[model samples]
Target: LIGARLSGGGGMVSVAAGVERVGVLLEGFEGVEIAAVNGPRSVVVAGEQQALDGLVGVCEGEGVRVRRIPVDYASHTVQVEEIEEELRSALAGITPRAGRVPFYSTVTGAPVDTATLDAGYWYRNLRHTVRFEEATRALAAAGHRVFVEVSSHPVLVPGVEETVEACGVGSSVVTGTLRRHEDGPGRFVEALARLHVRGVGVDWAALLGRGSGWPVDLPTYAFQRRRFWLESGRGAGDPSVLGLAGVDHPLLGARADIPATSGVLFTSRWSLWSQPWLADHSAAGVTLVPGTAFVDLVVRAGDEVGCGLLSELVIEAPLVIPEQGGVQVRVSLSETDDSGQRTVQVHSRAEDAGPGADWSRHVSGRLAPEAAHADFELTQWPPAGAVLVEEAAERAYQDMAETGYGYGPAFRGLSRAWTRGDEVFAELALPEEAGKPDGFGVHPALIDACFHAGVFRSSDAERQLVMPFAWNDVRLFAIGATALRVHLTYQGTDTVALRLADATGAPVASVGSVVARPVGTEQLRSSSDVSGGRMFRVVWDRLSVRSVEVGSGFVRVGSV
Candidate 1:
């Protein structure tokens, strides 16, 4: 596998050309052939090292945006023909039997007879081009609704989904078992969770052994939704200073320069009403800031300096929005170190707190100078073979809401979107009616909308409510963007690295990596104590329990 990534099986070339165009290009290549017909413009070429290299050069020289797919062995071409007889000999003794489930053949693009599963059939299966699209079409035509790829890594999920879409299978869902480079057991459980959320019944007892303990009945805790915002003591600075320049971010009040200090401080305030969207996100019924909002603050801070990338950020506390008032927000960026890195921290206190009150640190991170961006030369507008995501803007929030992300008007900013293979291109904007505070580097509403655009690339299983777990190498270019054009490329199973640009396509911000994960109510609850020492506990012994068996001469008893 390492060889496949770095060298070995050589590279696979993806050319955005029609079949005839690709056939003309491969006329002189001896070891190359069309591996698959993915979409109208998606043509893949597999071959030995020299032939693959020549094909890539030819495609690029002709102004085609060719992508090199990593793989070690050249399968489905003449090179694999050399192992055919050996494979047949090695499998000659195997006898095939019919199974409970119908086995569809990717080689034949249809269901195969058990008698045809002979040595020669296996040999040809290995030597032939994988007819994944045809097989998918066959399944769709046969009314299959769910397609699950049982592989450690979901290498064919995108293809399968694309084929299903092309085959006009509207109700179909495509999912996988695990992801590459992830914890096997954890990923397996996650896969099962995905299935469960999609309404797939799983035999939990069989999978986890029947001896497992039964569920314990317990009393549930009721969370207090008391207000926590301070009404006064915002800062030491003159209140009139806010009249100068300002930003539209709730976490940031106004930009102020530290007179003696080398860096700048941004002051802001947050309440449930600061942005109506805050109320839409609650963990265990308590309204706290989502981690993705913090990413907005960090990236905005990174943009203040030349550093656009948030190299690292650790969220320590749940910044709960109080019921009556709100919290005062301050984002501080220290002087740049010798390595051109700066310390960034987010601190907040109740608005009613005294001037001498200590501010609690919520998030801290390091901001580094902009690194090289993985630019896709998107200058070509949607690329040659990209597919436009129809009605993406209309369905973006609806689909996300179905998975527990109930975005409000402020958070529903996806304007339009498109998808090209694994990459998603989208345009997001902060609505003027959102009425955000002014002077934000990049308002959370707008940035959050940028993340929301990811819905365009989501499968049903991926539609769950996910939040940014960690951010790395985030860089900002242009600051205070109300509208943005975003390019999101998949980095892993649950991670996407993004590049941000203004409406005119000017670079705004780029992220090296941002990992996201599905979040549940339990995981989102605030651990901080703001209930004023009021706590509740239930004593199970206080409750009554009675059980009795009844027979011809026995007594029966039951209690509620």
Candidate 2:
């Protein structure tokens, strides 16, 4: 009845033939009016509720099943139909005028001609189907930035969102009735102002003063360039020039230029070495020879300040050989003192005159200072052909879990092992208090924590976080006293295959596929929330580690 009052009741039609005949009978009455010319759709009769119920009963007694809707009255009867002729005569006496802005027709889903706003257009509007969706899409495509639903309830906003996504339209549509504050209209204005600021960086006042138009052109801004120094030659005392290379400079003005000197400092070579080997294989035997060379450089510069500039340089020359049956090589280094004294040092080793000897070999000493280095010597390589699986996994796990919050109890007793050319696997037992009522439960958050620990221990140190982009084939079977095992196989940078199992190695949950990416500390920090208060309080009088085992394993348990 409310909808009929607003639309003039011309769009209602009874689908049932019996109801249509009843509508015809009601139209014959004097009080009612046929306000619309609705076509072969469900007819809406608007009148007093009691009278409508009585009419329904009368129709039902005549073998017509009449269904009464939650409406007030009967509409679109003959009484109202008679007014059409009178309205036509009244409109024919007046001259129509044109409008500036174009108005669209919801009935036809297209623009309507203002000059042809005649009686037929109004009559057709009552019979034709309402193509609201198409009309809304047209408005959106025509660059309408905002849409307001002025109805009593919000029913069109959802349809608009779906339509916009489907049609690939970029305009923002909003429903005003859903605002939370009592002063919703004010809030809407503020939201529009904020949107303008975000889109064009113009304040609301400035936008309003400029008639809400955006600027077309703006001046370009530039930053100051930084300067650096590059050596023209291979010595510290050699002349250097200032330029923008080899150093990262800030966007600030350059510093004051320093005074230059006319005299140039040069370095002298100190040592050099060269070795050559020759061999011949015949019926008699083989012959071989070897030699060596070295060099060093020294630099000297007069002290304009206090101390004279001096530099000692050394070079390890590589070996050179002929393309014949024998080979030759060279090695050398030169050093210069403060007084420009140069020295050279070289050494060579070769074997070329024996049954198992070859002339194309050269040996040299270590080029770097000797320091203690840790190396893992594996008995055999992994069966999967993955090198350093255990070490790499350890590093990855440590890096992933270095959040300083300490790992969860689910990560207790974690261990990893790799079989050469076969597979790399790791297992960890959950602490007893992990999933208890007073302890952390097997919720999504706790699962994420455990995942971080596993990933951190098995990824690169630079990888701060591994985003679990997806989950597949995941299942949770039992809880309490059961450990969780995570098995992972990396395919590439963005894809990984994962399998999750319980303490007994039974497949609890398996994800045949997942995507992951190595994230940096900035991303991790921004993604995580920091809480201030204590997460959990342990009422313990004292706490200490009883003992620590170095080689066998490390275990620490405490009590409150």
Candidate 3:
């Protein structure tokens, strides 16, 4: 059939949209016929190869997406008549039988008795138009809402969804059995999961029934959204020069030696004007501080005391920085204990807050002696055994933005990424326009970019919005680096060990472990207004003119 069609120059082309308009355009062409209506707008036309090519050109000229079907033969057109005798002779032995189950025939655009599917019927189907859209509509009209295409790939799911939607039939779910190139056990399991999420009951034994394979356990802790901009505070000048004692940290301005108590308080104030890069981090349409900034504060506070390790910092809330006004942060440290560990807590409130305003405690942790570290290196540049994640790694930032993690130029430092067994590595740089890295012990944006690399883990699981909830054994070894190379190895559950280095592979910082938890939009909305503001206006669309006769006793009002 392909040889014959190739000799005769017959082919097909598909248009993605403008169904009605494209149908009108096709009417003026020669030898072309509407081969299939897969969906409301997924239309396929087939005829002489020259006419099909012309149609594709016209569609492209009008800005409609068109794809040429890879085939030398055109079906469902007058060209089939040339092969009619050959098909009849070849299918002469076909014996159609009645089936016990119902069958919706695209040939008839409705359910048909299978007893009528004889060789002649098959021949007619081959030579006639394919009414896929109409057949799908028939299924929807018959109260069928859930559609699972039992095919090797999901070429028809989108068309099924669009067809069912145009029927105005409440709602429907369209899924597929497998996808091309993703025919593995995990993809099949994901297909099952899609059904499960839509209230469908699936057999659990299907996956576990074969082997001793088990699912990887994920973290279940609830956490807040991430949108923090942490600035590594730089010592401005001598604090003792003024009457009061102060800390030279960029984020901290004054230090108060509490009288009669063994505690000390370090204070700093931040505003958009002062730390403009903070505007880059936003979640649920509100600007908030990056969670890494808390780690930065703890690291600085550890330097202030003799402690060099941030033992563990757990976030309790997200610090939302309002568009106007500044927020003041207080990092309070307790006296060293028997273990030489001092409790540290971070709290914040607006600068103009009233006397009775309650301070929001964002994070709390303990500073302790540095822990022994594992020796690691990223000097191999692209890494020895890692492979580019391809499209997933390239689309990292775009995917994050879609899930409410909007990043501006400051935090968009991830250049390239690669993955190896149980580990992900990223190339990061703090954009120069973000600001000078002069004062920071470890610039917050650059460090935060390390966490962004974690998104690549979803290549094996579901894509989710995750935030760093706990920092353990964090220590900064260098300062004022504009670029970094980071390595994150999966520890357990949702935790990873972070190793940071400079462009030349020199060590800058390390985290014994960083634990992450998923963030929900509901939790974000609780603290900020993320409600949708909707407005409506009437639109006039072309309406068909029609008339109906009035019954003897019934009165008809409106004019057509």
Please give the TM-score that candidate 3 achieves against the real structure: 0.51
lDDT of every predicted structure (CA atoms): 0.70, 0.36, 0.77
Provide the TM-score for each candidate, comma-separated: 0.47, 0.26, 0.51
lDDT of 3 by residue, 346-407 (tens): 98876656567778788999998665354775665556666656654348877788777888
lDDT for 531 in candidate 1 is 31
Model 2 Cα displacement at 340 (Å)?
69
Task: Give the Å error, residue 500, model 1.
Answer: 2.0
Better of 2 and 3 by lDDT: 3
Give a tens-digit lDDT track for model 1, residues 1-560.
22323246545677766667889999898878887765545678888889878887777566454667757666666666666766778899989887777878978888887767989888777567777667778888999878788998986776777778777868666788887766888778877877777777777756664432433435487655775653333354654566534644555556776777668788777776555567655544666777768887777666656676678887766687766556778898998788888888899887656557778898888988865464533344444555557678668867766666656666677877777777888878887555653655666667777777677677886566566767777665666778778888887668888888886577877877777776676655644333322133211233345544334232323443
Better of 1 and 2 by lDDT: 1
Instruction: State the local distance difference test value for candidate 3.
Output: 0.77
Point to the candidate with the largest lDDT: 3
Clashes of each: 27, 74, 8
- For model 1, the stretches where C-alpha displacement exceeds 4 angstroms are 1-250, 254-267, 273-292, 299-309, 316-318, 334-336, 352-360, 369-377, 436-438, 527-560
Question: Which predicted model would earn the best TM-score?
Answer: 3
Question: Order of candidates by lDDT, top first?
Answer: 3, 1, 2
Q: Which 10 residues in a row give candidate 3 its minimum summed lDDT?
A: 530-539
